[model samples]
Target chain A: MKEIYLDNNATTKVDEAVFEEMRPYFCELYGNPSSMHFFGGQVQGKVTEARGRVATLLGASPEEIVFTACGTESDNAAIRSALEVFPERRHVITSRVEHPAVLTQCRNLTQRGYRVTEIGVDGTGRLDMEELQAAVDDDTAIVSLMWANNETGVIFPVEEAAALAKSKGALFHSDAVQAVGKLPINMADSRIDMLSLSGHKLHAPKGIGVLYLRKGTPFRPFLVGGHQERSRRAGTENAAAIIALGKACELAGQHMDAENTTVKALRDRLQDALMRIIPHARINGGGAERLPNTTSIAFEFVEGEAILMLLSELGICASSGSACTSGSLEPSHVLRAMGVPFTCAHGSIRFSLSRYTTEAEIETVIREMPPIITRLRQMSPFGREFLKEQS
Target chain B: MWDYTPIVKDHFLNPRNVGDIPDADAVGEVGSLACGDALKLYLKLDESKDKIVDAKFQTFGCASAIASSSALTEMVKGKNLDEALAISNQDIADFLGGLPEEKMHCSVMGQEALEVAIAKYRGHEAPVHSHDHDHGPAYPDQEGTVVCKCFGITDVFLKKVIETNRLTTPEQVTHFTKAGGGCGGCIPKIKELIDEVMGARPEEPRKRPEKLSNMKKMQLIQEVLERDVRPLLWADGGDLELIDIDGSKVQVAFRKACAGCASSGNTARMVEIKLRDLVAEDIVVEEVPA
Candidate 1:
């Protein structure tokens, strides 16, 4: 069966162009960028060019970009550096809906005698800016928020939130892992002191990420070792993956309009069709501004793992916020923080699109999704009651 | 993705008896929308009102849940009420070629529904589905206080699962019954219940032998400490190492959270009790500096 890959928020297929760009670095151009020989000097030039490409896409200077292993590493480095740089500060601020990369770090800090406040989200998955405003005080060392939620695709007003943090002398960081390529971000005119982005989310290979540090920002190194990444991040560079990410970023810049237009249309058509054809279903973050490529739909009276299993049988890949799929026995933290009802929270399925998502795939999903919901509902006791009431 | 068995996938894809018998003689329902999974099982008894002539199920849950329900209906079709009640959650899992450990609760849900249906059929008051308020016991028919508020599970229900599954840890209890899977405020209580249930087991194989040499007694003491005592401490994020064994006195040092805990004295007393019960009646446990 032909696979209809839709789970882009989880990860994306490496773009062919990005793959080609990194192909030569594995064995042929296998020189460390820091080596003193001529062979290493040539590889260093390519590395510099790649850095410039990545910088261009983010509207950041090449000097501000420090390559890390992946988005988690970038997130860790950004948050840890801020807390270390401001030792007198004893508080951290984040949101309940942040990815585990940021949320876990902030939570672990509490064990070390640091106060951590997690701002809640409203019903539409929108950040409670008022709660953030109230939480940010002079003792707060950093405020870490995600630019866009991975599950609901709800966008956060990080620029305004950063201003709030700045007013309190707290460094603001954004984990833009899900937002960087899908949404245009210009760090040059932003108040965000640190920004983290991953490679695989935007069609680059995995194992490469960037931490954008604003120039003149007071900082401390998270990893102290050899002078790779200007000693900001230690360990030998993942040379090939870095090259891949740079090419992917340049391509993302060129395809930004298409992502917003063509891809957005595909997502809307899928969402509208499913809502129309299926009964007792609702979009999770329908009231909020969301990324163009993502839609989370909650099918009532059914669980998400059952829906996903049926979809997997038909080779239609997607993800779920249901407790069963997550192995947590509770629904997604993102949906839970949004105050979604348990009836819907246990049944939410997320479908994330990418530039490679075709119109036919969306049509296939629209056609196949209603029956899957219908079949599961037919087998559900609650669904039977709802059907009886309808009759 | 869950490593669902082939039998599970087959059952989920084409579930057996996937609807209600409107004239069902005995209907049993367990779980709620809030719990993320639920099953409504129906049984049509024969004219004798003893044997289950037909069984069907309607489920709102994951693949394993649906599969477990389907497997239960298939397993109980021609069995009498007593025989059907004899079916354990493990039997239901075994019928489906075994479910994942985390998905064990699905099989337990199937078994609970069966018990509720049979109890209701016998004209006994089974408050399995009476979840009208949050503060009341989740299953009023069952005894004991509520433990997991998120799932509205009671201590009696948790103990039953823990005992039947031979579960030793709080995490295993969560997998089987979702007792401490929520806010986990009741985790300490769950651990106490586990100890209570495990301690009450009949004819435990870990009992101390009646006659033993000093060498055998020392080995048995170490075995009991490693096998029984340390695991219980580890559950509470504490640990202990046997530092020295001098005659009847067993010297130990606490590590992690147990080292300087205000309750270390109490913990040491508990260890002494366990050692006496399992190793030797006169054995003593002493706390020593690390």
Candidate 2:
């Protein structure tokens, strides 16, 4: 069975162009960027060019980008620095549906005498702006919100939310990991003070991430070692990944239209067909404006892992919002925050498409998915009860 | 994706006896959707009612859970009712090659269902066990302390698994029985259980001298940290350093992997308890974040 990879939101395959660009950096141009020699100087110029390309993608100056390990590190660096710089402040604000990188860290901060306010989301996964407005106050040190949710691909009002945070004299940060390549962002308009992005989510390799610290955002070093990243971040940069990220970003500029059109159509087609064929199937966050490539479906009375396993057998790879898939007892925080019922939450599957997802693959999934649900339902005890109720 | 054995995959993909039997002599149900897994089992007895001629199940759960339920029905087919009732969770795991430790609860669910099924066959109303604390070995419903609030695991179950399995680490205890897999307020208690069960050394119970100087107390605390705590932690790619001594309250920084380790709460308790046993009974240890 040929693999149909629709779990792109988890991690993308590195583009051939991006890989080729990074190839030279590994063996040929292995000079230390911090070194003074002509050999190192040449390599440093390439890195600087890479930085400019990333900056161009976000519509920001090169000086604003600070490279870090990954999206989590970027988020940590940004949030930790903000709290440290404003020692008098003791409160933080974020949405309940944020990725664990933001949510767990903020929750952990509560133990250190920091009060965190997690703004609620509606059934459609849209942030409640009134609640967010009420949550932000003078004592708030930083407000961290995700530009887009990875699970539902629901876009939050980052620009509006960031502005609200800044009104109360709080530093605003957005983890734009899922949004960077998918959405056209202009940091020059500048409501966002810090934005964290990862390489892997946008067809670049992992091990490299960027924290766009809009210049003069009271920075404190997270990984303090050598004077790398202008002493804002320390330790040596992942040179190959940084170079690959630049190429990926430059390509992302060209591919945004296809992502919003062709990839989005594939997602919509798959979602519409599955919902039509399978009874009691529903879409999560269907009411909101979602990313072009993501669709989350809940197959009622069926287990997500069982559905995923059946899908895996046919080489249709995707992720689950199910707790069993994560080895935890609770389903996804995003679904729970949106008040998705227990019947649906444990059985949710996320199909996040990419530019590479073909129309034929979507058709195959549409054809294959209905029978799998029917088969699982036939074996399920609750499915029988649910069917009787429906009848 | 949980690295389930090939047999588990097979049982899951082609689960046996999937539907309920119409003329089942006994029906047993366990778990709930809120708990993330549930099983409904039906046992049809032969003419004598001594042996199960056929068995079937209906499950609402993950792959491992469905597989475990399916596996149980297959294992009990054409078996004596007493023999079927005797099969344990470990037997189910062994029948399916093996299950992941994290998914061990699924097998436990199967055991609970089978036990209830047999009880029903014998006309005894089985005790109800839900996903919450009511189902644990030692909870409010039972005799011992409910150690892990997250998974509703009890100290009695913790101690039993430790002695039965000859377990050493707190991580192992969570694996065999989900005792400390929760908010971890009970981790210190788990560490103490492991210490009491595994470290069965005759304690001298160091008697305190009257009117010891502050300097002497600090030295004793430092001596214990260097001698006892740091070495045990260093063996596990973890280390700690004593920061300050505020009378009986000792502040320390957990360094290396132990600094932000999930088990550090238990590890910290292990240190405090060990210090009290070695240094002073009233000595309290707190981690000052590094």
Candidate 3:
């Protein structure tokens, strides 16, 4: 079956070029970067080169980039370090629509005796900037926010939020896992003190990420042990994946605009088709300035799981509801925060296209989705009565 | 996605009966589209014989909805009025193997429509009693706390679920009674009740090296996790210890990853399946965080 993968927000396929660049390091150049030997020195060179590449992508100095295991680890490191650096500062402000990597960590911090103020987002999934400003106080340690929402692809004014945090004498950290490759993010002009990015969200392999900590930030190490990452992160370097990340970052810098244009067109086409063909269908994350490649639609009378299963049968891979999360009982917190009705929450489908997504695939989904939705809705007692009620 | 049984999937894809009767003797509709699911049933009654002649339905919602409608139609067709009324969600699920308990209400909706339609055939209003048995309080309980939003089951209903379905795990309670199935807030409650119910049952002496099939082994694992393992983890702010069986030993892990966790042995005692718990004596429970 010709599988059409549309769950880019969850994770992405490794680019062939990135994979090829990484293959040699895993085998021939498999040396511990920390070792004093020449074999290791060569690996260290590659790590330095990878760091430079990742730094270049964000317009940051190579010395400031600290590679970690993943975005979650980077986030944990940033939040934990911020809290430790300013223990007396009990107040922390953040938006409600952050990924669990930030949300759970904040919640954990709250339980550990810190007063964390979570600001809610508007119906369009935009943060309340005024409310955010009101929440931040002189005692605030940090204002941690995400660059782009993983679920809705909604972008936040990271620079503006960072400036607000800075004005309040607090540091700012943005989880840029979803934004680094897709959007134009410049670390130099931005007031962001710390930013997290994952390689998997780009074309690189998993288990490798970069955290850009501004040169003069009051940061402490979350992982303690090795002198790796300049004593910032303590772990042996994932030399191969890091090398792949560098290549992925280089490629992202070049193809970013072209991919955005192509993917946006495809996304718009898919969204238009779904709205036209399916009754009571609307984009859940509409009216927000979202990433060009993503679209989330709610099929009013159908279950999200059923829609996904049908799509799967046709080799069309996608995600839906809270069902997308393994064993999770709650729907997407981002959607819920935006006040998406529960009636449509469990029935929302996110179609996240990539740079590789084709017009043919978009056309196919447009053709297939309407019928799949219609069939599921037909099976729905809710849809039947809804139509009855309408009539 | 909810782990739907193959039978449920099959029944959903190739539903037994669908579409509305052109001239139905009676029609029944329940639930609203606003509620996220609805069912409309049409029936042709052979009044002289006091039996159902033809049945069909139009459903709006998930796979379970369509399957339930189809199953209801099959259950009623060619059956006497009393026999049709006697058909329960369990019967429909049994007819189609089994359905995920969260989806058991889908079948229950069919049963509800059937009752309403039968009452309509009798030329009387099917009094909208609060007790919508298929997903409502199946067991009489004056004081049991209500759990399972999808099914509205209680502690007594859970006990009946344990006894009737021979449910030995939290998953089974969820499947049978729809408890601990939605939002999963009541999973611990379901697990607790399973232990209490099993404790109430007379203990059978341990069977030595009993040859068990894969299905039996899965049942054991489910029971062990629900009755024995889940509650311990629940108390610790954690849950699912393992996904399924791996070779001989029952593979287990932690739900939310245990706080200050260094050992997996504490989680082993939580498994309810007697066989797996007994097997734990010989086999080591390996805990790996994924």
Candidate 4:
């Protein structure tokens, strides 16, 4: 069977165009961009040009974009940098439902005597704006929030959050790892003072990410090492990955319209069909505005691991809340935060589409999923009880 | 993804005889929805000697939890009470090679059901209800709050399972209670209670003196059989007659309730085997029907 991959939210396959663009840098153009020799200077020009392309994608000046290892590093740099800028501001504001990269960093900061006010989210996984606004005070140094949730695909109101932080005279940062390419975000117009984006989320290879620090933004150096990324982010540049990231951005810009419309339709169809076929199944964050490409569903009485395994057998690639956590034992914290019942939480599956996803692939999943669910439920002692209880 | 052992996968994918059997001889229930999982075991007994004739189960939880219950039913069926009681959680995991350590409680839950079922058949209440041991703080009064919802473990259930399993610490309670292991919200309280129960040694330890004379061993064994072991056997429609004791070996013959039981092997394991485990490992015992 042709593998039907639907877990784009987890990661995407590298685009061919982006790969071809990066191939030469791996072998032929191996000279360090920092060297002053003619051979190295030529590669430096290519690196500078790639930087400009990435800057164009985010509507930022080339000087403002600093290449980093990945989105987590970018997020850590932005948050830690802001904390260093205003040491007196001991409190920071963030949401409870952020990705672990942000959450763990916040937790580590909390351990270091910094007060972290973790704002709650509504049932739909949307931030509680009132609580967020109230959380900011004189002691609050900055506000960090994710532009899009990885699990439920719920989009936060970054513009409004930015305005809130700006009004409070606190720096605002966003982990836009899931948002940058899928949605049009302009660093020039947006109120976000700093932003982080990962290449893998936008069809670029892993290990390459960009951190955007708007001009005159209060920040401190996170990585203390050799001067690279214009002394903003230190370390030798991932020359090949950066080139691939630049090309991926170019492709993202070209395919943005198709991704929003065609991919949206495919995702919607999958959601609708899954709901129609499976009883008691519903989209997570149904009331919230989510990314067009991601759909998370809770399959009652079915453990996510069991479902994912069954899907794997059929060569259908999809992710589940239970399959993505600690030892694959804990359900998605996002689902738990939304007050999802354990009966369904363990059974939640995320089917994230991509521009590469096809109608035929979606059709195969729609046709195949119900039987798989039924088959799994039959094996479930809990599922049998749930059906009996409902009946 | 971790590759599942075929048996673990089989139990997870097609758990045997799931769902409750109404009008069952005994029912053993553990865990709850708030605790992330729960199990309900229904059993049919032969009644005459209290041998389990059939077992069915229903569970709500993760893959391992469901798999454990499924395996439990398969292990317990066709075995007499003593034989079934001897089946430990390790045996369950070993049957499938092994499960991940995080999933060890799945096997623990299986063994718990067997223990609970055996308790029910003997008309003995689970130790969870006994108010004998008073650990430090008073147990929670609210039913819902008392139970650690992540693992479906209650303080009452924890106390009982701990006593029954001879668990000495909060970690051991986790093995039996399956609490403090899920969300870990209740770990501190669980650990505190376990320490309180196990901190000070019991005034009179359950373990007999290190080395007793052969005469003393025989006298004690006779006393244990008449007081503890015999009553339990008689309640289950079985009786035992002491044959001989030779150098830590006690030979016994079956009588009354277990005279010709098809599950006599189980009865022997229960009476003879349990005697060995409870008394001393060195005190080997053999069961031969009279």
Best by DockQ: 1
lDDT of 1 by residue, A163-212 (tens): 99999999999999999889999999999999999999999998899999
CAPRI class of candidate 4: acceptable
Minimum summed lDDT over a 10-residue window in model 1 chain A is located at A218-227
Stronger candidate by lDDT (1 vs 3): 1
Interface RMSD of each: 0.6, 1.8, 4.0, 3.6
Q: What lDDT tens digits, residue by residue, belong to model 4 across residues A184-237?
A: 878889899999999998899999999999999977888878789878888888
Model 3 residue A191 CA deviation (Å) reads 1.1
Clashes of each: 0, 0, 23, 5
Residues A161-280 of candidate 2: C-alpha lDDT, one tens digit per residue: 998998998999999999999999999987899999999999999888999989778888888888998999888777888889999999999999998988888888899888888899
Tens digits of per-residue lDDT, candidate 1, B1-290, equal: 78889999999998999999989999988788878899999999999999999999999999999999999999999999987987778778878888899999999999999998999889985444443334343344554567787777888888888866778899999899877777778789999999998775446466657877889888988987876777677555467889988888999998755778889999989989988887788888899975
lDDT of 3 by residue, B12-33 (tens): 7787666777788888876544
Q: Per-residue lDDT for B110-220 in model 4, tens only? A: 777667766766778544432221121112211223546554445655765554344666665665455665567777888766665445443553665677777887887
lDDT of 2 at A199: 95
C-alpha lDDT values of all predictions: 0.90, 0.85, 0.76, 0.78
Q: Which of candidates 2 and 4 reaches a greater lDDT?
A: 2
Candidate 2: residue pairs that collide:
none
- Candidate number with the higher DockQ (3 or 4): 4
Interface RMSD (one decimal) of model 3:
4.0
DockQ of each: 0.65, 0.38, 0.25, 0.27
Candidate 1 matches the true fold with a TM-score of 0.86
